[model samples]
Target: MCPPYFSSNTYFSNAIKITTFLAQSYTTMIRATFLSILVLFGVNLLAQNTPYPTRFELSGGTETPTYAEGIAYYQKLDADFKTIKLFTKGPTDSGKPLHLALFSKTRNFDLKKLRAEGKAIFFINNAIHPGEPDGVDASMMLLRDLALHPERYPALDSVVVAIIPFYNIGGALNRSSTSRVDQNGPKEHGFRGNARNYDLNRDFIKADTRNARSFAAIFQELDPDFFIDTHVSNGADYQHVMTFCYTQEDKLGGVLGEFHQKTVLPSLYAHMQAKGFPSTPYVNAWGQTPDKGWTQFPDWPRYSTGYAALFHTIGIMSETHMLKPYEQRVKATYALLEGSLKLLGEKRAQWLALRRQTKAAVATQTDFPITWKVNREKFSETEFLGYEAEYPLSKVSGLKRLQYNHDKPFRKIVPFYDHYEAENVVKKPRFYVIPQAWFNVIDLLKTNQIQMQTIKRDSSIEVTQYKIDNLQTSRNVYEGHFFHNNLEVKAEKQIMAFAAGDVLVPVDQWRNRYIVETLEPKAQDSFFRWNFFDAILQEKGGFSSYHFEEMAAKLLEKSPELRQKLEEKKRSDEKFAQSGDAQLNFIYENSIFAEKEYRRYPIYRVE
Candidate 1:
């Protein structure tokens, strides 16, 4: 360029332009590469944070989240949102912290304070049977959505949601792929039994484990208006993905019962149906096909819902079908919970009033029913959607096996027998005097938070008592005890002396229903039926045939009435007539030598 005789200004200008072009090109390439990375990283972050079903689909697959994962989800929610607060109640049987994740607009987990703050409480217990882990995962997703997308769950504003993230932590930790063999699609799941191999659901009333005792404390502390325990059903295939086991209305009774039946349950079904999940009552019929008929499941205090009912809480056990895909089950469970919370929020005042009315009624009622019998004639009919079931030959066993043909779906009218009548009733006395010797029953009463006063002095009072006349005990052990059946009871009025420190359970309080149900001899699941009073059912003393021969004759002669009864028994029973020892034993049992306390119930009623 210099050789071409150009001016100094022109040469300088061409050099500056080439340098500027290179610098601009380099800067543009660097900026474009950096922006491309930012876009990719943002997409990855969005994918990771997107809530389930999307999250579950992208990462967790068809399997449920592990116990650790569930806790992490709660922890993350607490970290990310102002609405959630994470609490550790205590250590469970698995040595893991029993966690309760609370969701409220105000972020207050204190139940009493929350109630005072004008918020209705709704409690949820998940993974009760760890194998039925649908609720566990569903609950996590729900709380997340409620926090991140508050507009979606409008009902949460009026209610404080408390959830036991993993109710059966022991069972939840005992994970295996083959445990839930019947379930449709879960790579792995928790076992049914807790660490101690106990079923926590059945251990509720007994409080046999540390877990149950802790649960009792939690329940009494919260005193929630509504409670839910989630589960999965292993039964015949059906069209509906969701079903529920609500505390029986006939058993719950009074205004609370009517409210649940007429308003709460129907609204739950309607809300779920509107959300694309049709629901029904729990498939209570076990052996029978759904199209044929079904009865309401009887929930004893051993069950979670039944235990909640004693405290006048409206409890429902949500159950999803096991045959359905894991994703579908979880979604259905989430819908059920969402619907229930919405209904609870919408009718908070009515729920509060209903509970108040029930408590008032229970406080003054004189006669309370303990045992219930199904009213088969009083059933209502409903349309049932189910698959045709048949007994087909098993390919593995070469025997007829129960199978549901999902290919052949059918809908028909089915009998839904949900009504119940009190089979037995007990007069609610001023006080139930339990002797000091029955520490087992005493411990249970204390665990249930039943109000009891200890006697200060030895006192004799006229009261009604029971004598165990006959009972049939199971040969096998059930829940670490020998359960009884066919119990024959004889009531008598007696002047009984109670020592100091004896527990006096007054029936005038709110827990009157629980006291009567557990203490009354006629109640099906009473302490006596559970063999807590088994000592009363056995002969403490027996005589040898050689020693009691003369004594037997003398005893029979002393009481002609006893002799007549013995003769009638011998005449009727060939076995009694043939055995000499039987005659002697019968005479000995009738004689004064037999201890009166042997068959006498330790429980007495003071009125």
Candidate 2:
């Protein structure tokens, strides 16, 4: 370096200058890097401005339970009063396993001790419908409040409160923000029926849950003392959040007494009233059971409350109005749970008294003759063939335009009497009234989204042909009606609960004696070879060819056409499909019914 002799040459001078420039550049970059980090910190601080923060960590459930904030909150609850079981896989649907968090004070709270101290309370859950998301939301709120403020939920020591925030995991995921972004359905709608599109509520009694298995699992494992199912009602039908107990006539529901009334319904009612929310109640008796939950479906066996009530346990089902906002529904749910817990906590001398009385009444209960509504509005009168024509969607549109200048909502049915003709025109691609409404009363069909025909019999707006068209189905809806020649019954209730397989319904025996139902049975063209009197005398739950001859004898008394419809089998366009989409590869041919009679239940009052 000494030999190079300093900056004597210009080339040496330039090299020295370049080295100095490079050093300065390196120093500047280091300073710039520090400045960038400072800006980033400030931006993040601005993003999180709330004092009490919420982070949507998992993305689909709640705004809580994220790694950054809610973990500490949940941890606080776990540390204070409970054990958190990490369901590495909460539940599975199709092939995917879902992750869930189950928080309970497990061993800390002993059921035996609670029972010894007379302070045990079980939960009845409702609110699995994703569209009516309040029950689940309220569940989380209740969990947090109880977990954080144990003193508030003092009953936790005595009561084993289970928080099943999401009953239908898949449905909830679809409705949540993360999943809603790409929910798959008709037109990408957020409303998705399970994997198979059947309402879980209706799928209870039947065991056809190829769509989901959790319903069956929970039913067997937790025979909870009280059951609650939360749902939403159409805006037109309900005014506010309502409670349904077995109707007054059904006051015979022995165990669901004052405790149910005071602890569950009153609390929910009072809570919502304080919130200025509107509500209604189903007739105390009629709506309290799954069999009477509007229309019956095969899934009565799996209904949480239905199972509870059938076993003489307490049950409560709450329905919020659709018109209410999402936040309001959530608030309502919070109020419901809070009220329920408070009621449960309060000592009930009346409940114990009622329980003793209920047991006594049940022991002596009788099968008082079941004279049902054989002549409900649908069955009040039979208009002879050619008396009225079926109404289709197109005609209803025309009526709407003519009457309200299309200002009225697209109604499923119409106004005016003898609009019956317009209501039952089966000629159109979409007929709403005559066939749909008529078929259900006879217990001949099970369908959804049917067209309604307008009937002006009652002030109730449900008289719309479009609305009446949907006769809610039951597990054995037709068991009461199959009193024809081909189908036979002998002093027993026989029903084919599940769909008849291709070789099931014993077509040949049923073919000649009774009205054989086909894909498209001709309107009013029916023949029968049975008599009504003998059919009634037989006392079979399902009808048979023997009953058909009995019904024929009834033709001599009142209704003549009833006898003729036997032996009337026509090709039908109406098809029953297990999968809602109708894309599932299944043959709807030769569904033969077993001659087997449905088992009869001698229904007796519990109290």
lDDT of each: 0.80, 0.35
lDDT (tens digit, per residue) of candidate 2 on 1-607: 0111112221101223333333355543453354346446542222121111122211222232212132344344444444443232224353333323333444434434544555444564533455555565455556655554445566565455654544554554453344233221111112335444445554433323432345434433333444567665542222244434322113224354445544555565666567665343532222222112132111122344543443345665665544444545555656666666655555434444454465455434432211112112321111111112223446645542211122222212111111001111122111112222233222211211111223334321111111011111233432122222222212222222221111111112201111111111111111111111122233243334444444434442453343223212211223422332221111111112212212211110111
Where is model 1 poorest over a 10-residue stretch in terms of lDDT?
A: 1-10
> How do the predictions measure up, each by TM-score?
0.88, 0.46
Q: Which residues of candidate 2, in runs, are more than 4 Å off?
A: 1-117, 124-127, 175-192, 210-221, 235-252, 255-264, 282-304, 347-488, 492-607
Candidate 1 CA-lDDT value: 0.80
lDDT digits (tens) for residues 393-459 of candidate 1: 9999999988888799988888889998998888888999988888878877886678889999998
Report how far off residue 213 is in candidate 1 (Å): 1.8
lDDT of 2 at 296: 14
TM-score of 2: 0.46
Error of 1 at 81 (Å): 3.8
